[model samples]
Structure formats: C-alpha cells, structure tokens
Target: MNLIRLVLCVCAVFGTQLAQADATRYPLTIQSCNRDVTFNEAPKHAVSHDINMTHMMLALGLKPHMTGYSGISGWKAVTPQMKVILDGLPELASKYPSVETLLNANVDFFFAGWDYGMRVGGDLTPQTLTPLGINVYELTESCAFVMKRPPASMEDTYNDLRNLGKIFDVQDRANALIAHMQQEISEVQKTLPASKPRVFLYDSGEDRAMTSGRLGIPHALIEAAGGNDILSDIDASWTRINWETVVERNPEVIVIVDYSEVTAEQKQHFLETHPALQSVDAIRHKRFIVIPYVQATPGIDNVLAIQTLAKGFHPQ
Candidate 1:
C-alpha cells in the first residue's frame, strides 16, 4: 500500500515538472530578420504564408492556432495529405494577402518571409502589419534576401522550428522534431560516398536558367546529400543566370524543382534538346533528379529531399 502511494506521488510530481518545462513565459522577444519582435502571449489566431511555411506550422501541430493559410493556390496545389489536414480552414488568399484580408480574419500572428509572401518594401510587411496589432515572424532562410546572412544550412530550418515552438508554447514537440530530423540526416551521412557530385538546380526559364544559390535551402540539401551546388558561390537565392555559365560549370547531375508553373518533363526535354546544353554531362548522361517544390523549400520535407538526392547521386 505504501509503495503504491509513493509511486502515485512521484508520478504526480513528474507530470507537474513536464508541464512546467513546456510552459512559455509571456512577453517573450525573439529575433526575426535581424529585428526583435515580442509576443505578449501565444496567438490564438495565426496565418501562415506559402505552402512550406504552412507545412512547418502544421508539423509542429500549430493548425489549431492557425486561422487559415495563403500563397498556396497561386503557385502550387496543396497535396491531398495537406488538404485533409486543412479541411475546414479557409485559404485567405490565393497569393499574398492584403492587410485588409488579415484584418478581416482577425489574425494576430503571421508566418511569412521576403519573396515567400511579403516582399521587401511591400504594402504587406512587418512594419505595415505591426501597427494593426499583428505580429510577424520571418523564415530564416529568406533572411538572406533582406540582410547579410551566411550560406544556408540545415540549422536554418531547425532555428525556425525552434523559434516557432517557443512562440506557440510547444518547445517539447519542436525539440523532438529537430532531434528526429538530425538523426535522419546523420544516418544519411553515414551511407554517403566520399565523392561529392557537382549538381545544378534548374528552377525554370527558357532563355535563362533560374537556379538556387548558397542562400537557398537547395544548396544545403545538395551538400547534405554528398553533392555540391555548382552555383554555390553566387550571392543570391532563386535568381536567373545565363545558360552560358551553366555550360561553363559542367554539372554532373541536374536537380529539377518540380512545380505547377512548369512540368518537370518539359524542363527535362528542354535541357535534353537545348543546342547549348547538348554536351552538358547531366543532359548527355540523362541524370536528372526531380524534387517537388515543397521538398526543395525549407520545411519538414527537406530531410526527405536529402534522402532522395543522396539515392539519386549514389545509386550503388
């Protein structure tokens, strides 16, 4: 009887500690795009911009806190899995939401980034929204566009997760997710070969190739998968580059960013038949790896992207 009573007391104490550990203090300040933003309390009504940012929020179980999402239908359709997860939630806007749109929805928090949803000096920005009682959190990877930032790493994705977890009082869940991703990446690294393939990311464009630079998540993904981004030295994110440079670099493999705007097959066909790229190794060998736009972006699917790239780079 005494042992049972002692066990019950210990369990009660343990539960209390767990609750306390996960509890967030109010009026917390966090860094966002080189600026300090403070939250008085967990936001009950939040909106995420872009599919990748929405995925991050959902992966952390922040759907209940979210009012709806935007910037998806304008670019890509939500996957069937995401459709089910967002059954009743409305799509606030097909593209970027106006301040009036957010105001009408009564959202207190917004999760977006430069070029992801809100553009620099655009009408819908932190400065424009903050005055109307809405708080904004910028995606870490997109910070490169607005400020001087180091080349993107997996740590950038992890940092966004950590910050979101803190803001939403879900640190425990965030920590567990981070741990799982880290473990998966480490396992992938264990199986990688010593030789890193020279890879180029093909986003789009008929006249000029739109590719990822060091500031983009694809650079980190390629590196994690034992491959090097041919344009890693370029100080830009997703930007247009002359096809001549691509021919000069002579990439061993091409990573195609598949999206609704242009079909991957079409992009592959263009590269295969292009007069300038006829001699390119990727086209000559027909070595191309197609990655979903969401996977290529900064989100939970980044780990899966790395795994896919690794297999494509080293099939043996």
Candidate 2:
C-alpha cells in the first residue's frame, strides 16, 4: 500500500511539471546549428563567448543583455561602443571564459561560437549546463565544420540571421539587417567584373602566414565580389602556404590582411622592400588593398571591406 502511494505521488509531481510546461508560452523557437532553443519571451541576459558568435548577437541587437564576452583584449577592430562593453567585462583567457568566471556571472544563457564539447575536457556542454539550469546555443554557421557541412555564403548568412531573428523574436530587425548588407554587397559587386582579378590574401605573419581557403567567409566574400581568391583554389577555410608558392604566383592584386600588429602601411612597405615584389602589378599600380583584421574575416563588416576593395580595384 505504501509503494502504491509513492508511485502515485511521483506521477502527480511529474504531471504538475508537464502542466507547467504546457501552460508556459515561448515566443521564439529557434533551431541553431547545435541545438533547438525556445525563449519564453525575449532574452534579457546574454553572453557571447565566441568571437563570430558575438558578431551575430550584436547584429541581433542583443548587446543590451550581454553579461560577458571573450577575446576582447585590446580589440583592434571592435567599435568604440563595443569597447565600452569590453571594459565592463573581465578579460577572457581565450575564446570562452574560465568556468569559474562564467559561473560567477550567474547568467541564464551562454551563447558560444564553437562547440567545446571535447575541447574543454567535456565540461562546457548543454548536458553539463542542464544541472545549473543554463542553456547553450552554438552558432549555426560555426557548427558547419563539425557537421561535415559546407560553409555558408552571403545567402546562408542571411538565412542564419533569419534563424536568429526567429529566436530573438525580431523578424523585422533581421530582415532590415540582411537587406542592408545585401544592398551594400550589390553595390560592391557591380563595381567588379568577371575579368578575374588575381588576388593574393596576405592574412598572417612570419609566425604563421594565415590564408583563407574554401571554408571561410573571406573566400566567400572574394567569390561573391568577383575577385579570384588565390587561396580558394586550395582547400580549407584558413591554412598556411609556402612563401615560395606565393612568390611564384605573383598575383595582380595583393590584399594584405591586417591580422596582427603590422599596420597597412607596414604591409605596403614590406611589398616595396621585397626584392621579388619590386615589379609586381599590385606594387606598381598600388593595387594592394589593406584590410583590418576583423573586417578581413567574417561578419557584417565584410560588405564594407568589399566596398573598399571595389573602390581600390576599379578606381573609377
């Protein structure tokens, strides 16, 4: 008789929780790359621990709710306003915050750019977070790599914003952002033709010269803007290429990616100083394009970067 009563009590408790779930209404239902999340209303507290993820959240107008961020150590590319937010938060050791600092913030949600399931010794996962009542939303774009899926394009980027719009319950805002980016890209694309400009992206430095390949937004932007990304012919979004191969290609346009302390002027000086580049087309005609480290990578700023390159490439 006691066992029967206990079973009945357990069922009553489970039923109440189900009833509560049914009674609650979530305004947003979003399927991110890693998980499906339902926001009861609008998220009032958010922390973007991923660099790319931070851009997406900012694009969604979640800046007001941001509790913390990672990778803001003297951000070379963050706007003055973003810098204010950076100053308020503790400096992140890497892309994500240390477990202790994150828990101390006592946030309701944690938005990450990449899945650190195994990277962090299996500590930062939704499964682990469930106990704390915290949820994780991994950027859909960033998850493409692990899913063995193809990288996204401007179109896919719009789609991502659309998904985020749904999650944030900001459909109108998302559309406007996408439309603005589209128009800007169209303007830049119109400036370039299919003549196929040979562009070499000098993305990294002596430590390790990083180049964007097929998987990253850099190559996507190059393809969309009608510039032939020399590294695209190779595979991978970002990779290391030999200087010997670079000297051999002798591209017509040299896009010096400002991914380090080296300024644009320094890159130009390097080109001029190189014995092999004395007669290069980019150096001769000043076809060299300098891109900020942030703008050179993915995010909304890419359109502006394309516009800059368009102006330099056409000069009309």
Candidate 3:
C-alpha cells in the first residue's frame, strides 16, 4: 500500500509540472520591437535567420518546431557542431529570404532582427509579413535599431530566451537555461580581477572601422568580462567610424570578429600594419583577441565569449 502511495505521489508531482509547462493560453500576445504580436496558437512552422538566431532556436530545442533557417551561408559557414545540431534542416535561402521564398515555404513565424536579416523598412519586415499570416519575433538586441532602448546588457539576452520560452510554451526549458547562464556569469564574475581593460571590437571595415557601440551585444560581453568598450559612447549598435577615432581611443586590447567574410588573422594583420593605428596600444602590444562571430553576437555562445574575453584580457 505504501509503495503504491509513493508511486501516486511521484506521478502527481510530474503531472502538475507538465500542466504548468503547457500553461500558455491561446491568443497569446508578446512584444516584438515595440510592437504587440498576437499568436492565436504556438507557431507550427517557423523560420529563423542568421547564425545567432538559429543558435537561439536550437538551444531552446526548437528544432522540431522549425521548418528551416537562413542568413548563415551567405556570410558565415556553419561550424561542424552547428551542422550536427541542425540535423539536415533545409536552408531556405543562403542569405536573406525574399517574401516569395517565405510565402512558398508556408511558414507561420519568422525569427529575425533589424539589420540581422530584416532591414528597417525593408520588404521582409513584420508589417509586410503580418498581412501574409506570418508572425515575426525581433531580436531584443536589435530593437535599438528601430527604437530608443537602454544600454545593452545580459538581461536583453535573457529576456529573449524568456520570451521565446513563453511563445513556445516551453517556459520550463527557458527558465532553466536562463538560470544556468546566470550562474555561469556569476561564477566568472567572482574570478575576475578589479582592473577593467579598454577594449575595441573590430567587426569588418577597411577605410572606416566597423564596430559595436553601446547598444550592441559586444558591449555587454566586454563589460561582463571586466573590459570597457572604447566606443561605448556611440548610441548606435553596429556602425562605422573613422580609423582616426579608433587611433584616438587607444584601446589596450582589440577584439576581431571572426567570420567567413574576413579571417581573424587577416584583420589582425591589418591592424598591426595600419600606419594610423601603429601608435594604438593594442596594436603596439599585439593584444588581439579573436572571437567567433556567433559568440560575439547574442546567443548561447555569449557565455563562452565572456570567458574567452576574460582570459584574453587578464591572462594568468
């Protein structure tokens, strides 16, 4: 009798947990880029854009929910690990998918961001898709491109995960992931030294320096790793500034964003050889930290980016 009672108790606990997991009601409304998007039901066929956005979906175990992905192969190659996780999912487009491409796929949802895949006032925006019965979820970090927002922080990433969890009725998985990330970041913070190094992020640009400003994910990663973004004063996210401005700031460490478009070594060589940047402290000392493009963006790889930067900034 006692054994049966114990079994019933265990079953009841799990049953209650499952019920909570499926608690999200229909006609759910969530905010995306300062707009309210209502979902009559959880998206059945969805598409995500960019490596980072795809990483977010995969981390949430949304593979079964996703129909395809886009915006990766055009600029970045899928790493071996990511390819395995993708599990033969189709690439609807090598770059940004046109409205016809998405419409033909018959997808109900699109996960993209301003400038990430959908440009502001572009043909593939939420306004354009909504009429065609597709719901759009804009990345929180990219929200700054369309509206005024506070400085970038880890919470922005957390909020994305949380919102995705709610959207998919997988709040439990989302909460657990957020908790794990928070714990990881806290552990890293405990080991960090008191000194904060001045850091510069070099994404890609020749005549002018393309880099992250206060609104970009790199700014948050730099701060978390006990480093200061030299261009934190700029209000834009990813924008171009003159090389003269980079020379003026005199960063102690330069972070090269690694992608297929430009190799990290090539970018480092340019900085090392540039006549104007010769006097820069980072260039003089050869203090270059190469971070993969995915890690530098907003995704599960953010924790790894912080760890990599912390080690690079203050190597023991």
Top of the candidates by lDDT: 1
List CA RMSD, all candidates. Answer: 6.8, 13.0, 6.4
Model 3 segments beyond 4 Å from truth?
1-22
Q: Whole-model Cα lDDT per candidate?
A: 0.88, 0.62, 0.86
Candidate 2 residue lDDT tens string, 1-316: 1222322433444444322222223755666665667677655656666444566566656667777666544435455555554555544444446566667777667766443221333666656765676666655445554555475466656766666666566665566666667766786776676577877787656534567666667777767767777776665655687765666676778888764466778867876677655666666777788876556655666776777776665565
**Could you estimate the TM-score for every candidate?**
0.93, 0.75, 0.93
Q: Rank the candidates by lDDT, best first.
A: 1, 3, 2
After aligning candidate 2 to the native by TM-score, how far in Å is the CA of 30 from where it should be?
3.4
How many pairs of residues collide in model 2?
Answer: 1
**lDDT at residue 287 of model 2 (Cα atoms):** 78
Candidate 3 global CA lDDT score = 0.86
Residue clash pairs of candidate 1: none
Q: For candidate 1, lDDT tens digit of each residue in 226-256?
A: 9988998998987889999999999999999
Query: Candidates 1 and 2: which is better by TM-score?
Result: 1
Candidate 1's TM-score reads 0.93
List the candidate 2 regions with Cα displacement exceeding 4 Å. Answer: 1-29, 34-41, 50-55, 81-96, 115-132, 271-280, 283-286
Off by over 4 Å in 1: 1-22
